[model samples]
Target: SQQGEEDPQALSIQEGENATMNCSYKTSINNLQWYRQNSGRGLVHLILIRSNEREKHSGRLRVTLDTSKKSSSLLITASRAADTASYFCATDTTQGGSEKLVFGKGTKLTVNP
Candidate 1:
């Protein structure tokens, strides 16, 4: 399968803390994307790092990719209560014109005030 699996099915943290999640895939990929879903709302794209990239950061979010090992990690620093939601990692196969993304089960993050 081209899909990845993320560790820690659920996480709980206090406001202002940081959270980290790890994902591992079974096959080579073209790119990996991280998404955040709030409650019943649609998923919002957080970041996308290609297989060639090592690490990328966005504000309070940090993502690391290791293509050789087929693994990735996501870190959210200074998490707030509003950050409570589900985080998902999606993998895009390397084949050109393939826009399909296989998503992981997801990590449910709960931040307490």
Candidate 2:
């Protein structure tokens, strides 16, 4: 099974400062995705990086993957209060003739104004 765990379970930063979160996973995966959830709301997809790619960016969000190290990192540039949310990294596990997404514990980010 492919499972992921994020580092710095909780982080607090001031507005305009960049925030970084790291995730590590086991086994093989086809792609790694980052998602954000504000409070009790549903998840909002941030970005997805394929196995063959090393890094990707979308607006203020950036994601990097290292298959050799089985790790990934999410960086939010120019953070804002609205960006305060729980970030999660999900990996697609394709093994045993089946595929499923395994999510990490998540990192809680707080951007103070």
Clashes of each: 0, 0
Query: Looking at candidate 2, what is the lDDT of residue 25?
Result: 94
C-alpha lDDT of candidate 2 relative to the true structure = 0.93
By TM-score, the best candidate is 2
lDDT of 2 by residue, 4-103 (tens): 9999999999999999999999888999999999999999988989999999999998899999999999999999999989999999878688888899
Cα RMSDs, all models:
1.5, 1.1
Query: Against the true structure, what is each candidate's TM-score?
Result: 0.93, 0.96
Worst 10 residues of 1 by lDDT: 92-101
Off by over 4 Å in 2: none
